[model samples]
Target chain A: MKMIAAQALVKALEHEEVTTVFGYPGAANAPIYDALSKSTIKHILTRHEQGAAHAASGYARVTRKVGVCMATSGPGATNLITGIATAYMDSIPLIAITGQVSSEMIGRDVFQEVDITGATAPFCKHNYLIKSAKDIPKVIREAFHIASTGRPGPVLIDVPIDLQLEEIDFQYSKGPDIRGYKPTYKGHALQIKKIVEAIAESARPVICAGGGVITSNATAELTELVEGLGIPVATTLMGIGAIPVPHPLCLGMLGSHGVRAANLAVAKSDLLIVIGARAGDRATGQTDKFARQAKIVHIDIDPAEIGKNLGTNIPVVGDAKIILQQLLNYVDEHYKEKHYKTQWISTITQWKNAKPTNNIKEDGNNEQYVNPKYALSVLSEVTKGETIVVTEVGQNQIWAANYYQTVYPGGFLTSGGLGTMGYGLPAAIGAKVGSPEKTVIAIAGDGSFQMSMQELGTMKQWDIHIKIILFNNYRLGMVRELQKMKYQMNYFAVTLEGSPDFVKLASAYDIPGEKITNNSKVKEALDRALSYQGPYLLEFIVDPEESTL
Target chain B: MAKHTLSVLVENHAGVLSRVAGLFSRRGFNIDSLAVGVTEDPNVSRMTIVVDGDDYTVEQVTKQLNKLIDVIKIRQLNPSDSVARELALIKVTANSSTRPEIIQIVDIFRAKIVDVSKNTLTIEMTGVADKIAAFEEMLKQFGIKEMVRTGMIAIERGNQVIKIGSSEESE
Candidate 1:
């Protein structure tokens, strides 16, 4: 049937079963907006293009589908750059559709014309510039396929406004037939066998899980593997919810700022099974010293990630879900006997038990400021470990990563790879929108909160119920801490002295909120926010001297 | 670091070159030289990238290239089992007195004089990089003017081949 390219694109979205799209409209994309107005897919208008992209990422994480975001050309497309980079760093599956100047004006530097495909090519998994209206369905199909496949990341499709307004005989395309793109899903049988044998031989075996575990939806398989073999699991920050944080065998996050026991366990391990993780520098300090005694068995879908950061003795290239399942089958056949890791587990337990206590006093806390760690622990307790906690970057992120116990898999979200400060609030909105029944919270520091605080208006407009916990430390806490450690406390631009009153700011959006200072009020304030059926903000006055550790 | 030549088969697309080049620069992998051209199949293009790195770097280079959606296959040619060649155009300062000597040197290197001016002789040479470098050295005494080279391209010896859906034994 002959129809405008914009109509066909919306139809293609429906074909892909896309229910919602986060976007900001502009003249360049007006035709697309007009077509979308008649479609069933819900459209969310974010305050900014970057917010739309981040919200899409959050939605993708929660829904386990390709998140879709849209923007016009020029500055609208440029605004999505940071969000796209953030998604790329974390391997989030996102499809960013952008409008362009008319095809005739493409290279003429016309109004609202920017080479978005070129701008985002370095980061996105793949991108396309649609030249023909007939290719919309094909490009859309390929974009979705590329975005959600092995080592999933963002993909871009830049459609010119002229093409959007053109009529075409559109026939819906079949499955992706890109000859150059085939992802290996099943691991090599011999490699899987080798991993099982290595696990059997080693006395001190540890499994380090990364974000890939959650991405592949293999948390249940991972949890079973851990329990079936009695192997302790240490997670990267991105792998926070791979296994329940409170599980007995779960070692809290491991790395530079990771828990002490996890680091010690990794140091002493004889065999390390690294799965679904790139093991970036943030997760592995001084590569040569990382897991020095361990023979690393790396399993990742992307062959490039196998030994890019750390040396691998046994490398299995395939999907994590399939490979973990393969390992589980082998375990069922050969590892029915009792685990030989009892002594090793005991040693790790000893190390975990002997870990030092926090420096904060256990008695009546200072009346002027609430301890961030203590407040987070209380937040975890109040929520019964069931809430979906998304954190902004810096001290608040680290505290939440360390203290919050995620009882369910896929419950923690953050900008792990990019460390984007303004991610939490928008991501919380996405998560809440995707899973309305689940309690969603955005934990932010005073500095990171203001980075995308305009998203508050988005929440009020959409009526998204997200309980925001703002940690008002009045400083860029993470950078300030770094200066304290490495620069002799020569602080310069790290302070946020002119920050607005967050509680009053929320009230401006008609979102009820209150500010609390004493440690005694943390639970009450958190409870009040959680029980409220609408968007609520609770601000805590955190000590500026508080350290991430 | 040892230098390794990787022949990658990719889809014939406009931005594929940029994708491959961008990946190298962003990942901090140094590319010594790169030569690309249409293959036997017009729809597929081949990129011969010479990367200077150790075993770890070579492995990373190959795997990262394979990650690009445009790339169909990658084959790292073994020096002993591959025929490598590079084409160079050298403009030598040729006066009537030095013309005979320059022609003799070019003849010895099995090169051809593609273009000639009163003051210069532009000689074309196609051989391995070492051979081209040696030929350039032979003409150095005659005062070479300018030179340009199409970086190295290679093919496997005998029936051994790199193609779509072929076994990765070559890699």
Candidate 2:
């Protein structure tokens, strides 16, 4: 049947089983909005295009599907850049649609026209500029495929205005057929053999799993592999959900903010088997010194990542699930009752036992201000395992990473790669939208919260029941900490002298707000925020001297 | 580390070469050498990259190259029976100082002087990577002031394109 390009977009999205989209309508994208009105897809009108992209990110993270966001050309599309880059850095699957000028007016710099495809090329996984209506169906399908497939990331489709109005026969296709876009999911037999050989020969081996495992839904496979081999597992921040925190073999998160034992374990391991992680700088501090003692067996779907950061002695290029399955097969073939050396396990166990202990004095009578770590411990104990936690960059993010115990998969969301501030509030709103049944809380520092605090209106407008817990240290706490540690305490721009009262700021948005000066009020504020039916904010005047991480 | 041949198709535009070469240097992936030339597509140029890495790394580099917007396609050519060559132009002092010695060395290497002035002789030579490196080293002894080389480019000796999904045929 002949249909408009905009109609084809809706049809292709329907084929992808996308039920909802988040976006704001503009003149350039009016055709798309009009077509969406006729389709079954639900479009959530966002206060800002950035919010739309971030909300889509949250939705995608929860559903493990490509979250769709739309905007018009020019500023409408540019607004989504930050959110798109956020998803790109985090490896979240997102499909961003934008309207463009007519093909005839493209090079003439028509009103509301921007070269969005070119603008987003460096950040996007892939992008397409639709010149003809006939290509809309194929382009949309390819966008979804590229965004959600191996090494998932944001993909953009810039639809020209004329094409959107043009009619074409648009039968929705279910797959992509570009000759150059095949992604490998199965491990090569020889590479798998080499990995198995390396594992068998190593006396001390540890597995470093990343978010790809969760993206591939290979948690069970990873758990089985590690448990079967009796090897310890350390996860990147994005890899939090790959293994249950309760599992004895799981070594929480590994990085600068990682568990002390996990970091030390990586430092001492004889063999490091990295799966689905690029070994990003944050995860591997001082790259030259990272895992210096270990021979690395890097497994990933993207082959370029093998030697991009650190050289891999054995590289397996395939999907995490398929590679794990192959390794399991190899292990079964070379079955041995005692694969792990007992001494290695015992040594690691001893290190784990000596891990840092959290102690909070019950009296709380000290004249000095509360430690952020202690506050985090208290929050962790109160929030327990049921609440979803979102953190801003800097001290608050580090504190949450170190203290918050995420008992559930996909429970923790933060800007790990980009480390963007103001990510907490909008992302938390998205997370709440994605999982409305859960209690979502965002932990933000004074500086970071102010970056995207305008999103509080979004939460209010959407009636999202997310708790905003602002650690009001009256400064950019992370930068301050860095100054003290590295810059010899010469605080320059890190100080926030005349900050607005967060309680008043939260009230400006007509959201219920509170300020807690005493540690005794933390639990009560937390309880009130959690119990509040709508959005709520609690500003805690944390001591500036306290180290959050 | 094993040598691998990569064929990359990129947009024929300025600064693309710098960006592409810069990526290699930053990554520290030792490119033994590379060759580039215009392909059948007038707008697209092909680069044959010879690097030392395993199969997985080679495939990865190719994928990354393809990811570049300027780059259209990339394929790994088989090492066996592939012709690899490089071209180098050397400017040497050709006055009474070292004119005879430079000519003798250039003649021995079967090189040609593409440009000649009263005081300078510019010799152009094309050969494999080792030969180019050797020629440059030999010319350094004769007070060589400047040298330029087009990196190595290669193609299979037979009529074989670096077709996709030809894993069985590669070996």
Candidate 2: pairs in clash: A304-B60, B34-B151, B34-B152, B35-B152, B35-B153
**Which parts of model 1 are misplaced by more than 4 Å?**
A333-336, A356-363, B168-171
Query: Cα lDDT of model 2 overall?
Result: 0.80
User: lDDT per residue, candidate 1, A156-251, as tens digits?
Assistant: 999999999999987887688887888998999999999988998898999999999999999999998888887899999999989988887888
Evaluated at residue A471, the lDDT of candidate 2 is: 86
**Alpha carbon deviation, residue A22, candidate 2 (Å):** 2.3
**Model 1: docking quality category:** medium
Candidate 2 lDDT, tens digit per residue, A1-549?
888888888888999999878898998889999999999987777778887888888888877778999999999999999989999988999999998888898888779888887677667887778867898888888888888887899998898888899988978767667555667899999988888777778788889988888788898888888777778888898887678665677776888878877888899998999999989988998888999999999999887788878788888888999899988887772453557556677877777777642334334654444455666666767766557788889888887776666666677888878888877887787787778898888989999988877787777676778888888888898888889889999998988878888888888888889887777666777777877888888877778887754
| Least accurate 10 contiguous residues by lDDT in model 2 chain B | B162-171
User: Model-by-model lDDT, in order?
Assistant: 0.90, 0.80
Binned by DockQ into CAPRI classes (incorrect, acceptable, medium, high), candidate 2 is incorrect
**TM-score of chain B, candidates 1 onward in order:** 0.96, 0.74
lDDT of 2 at A344: 73
TM-score of 2: 0.84
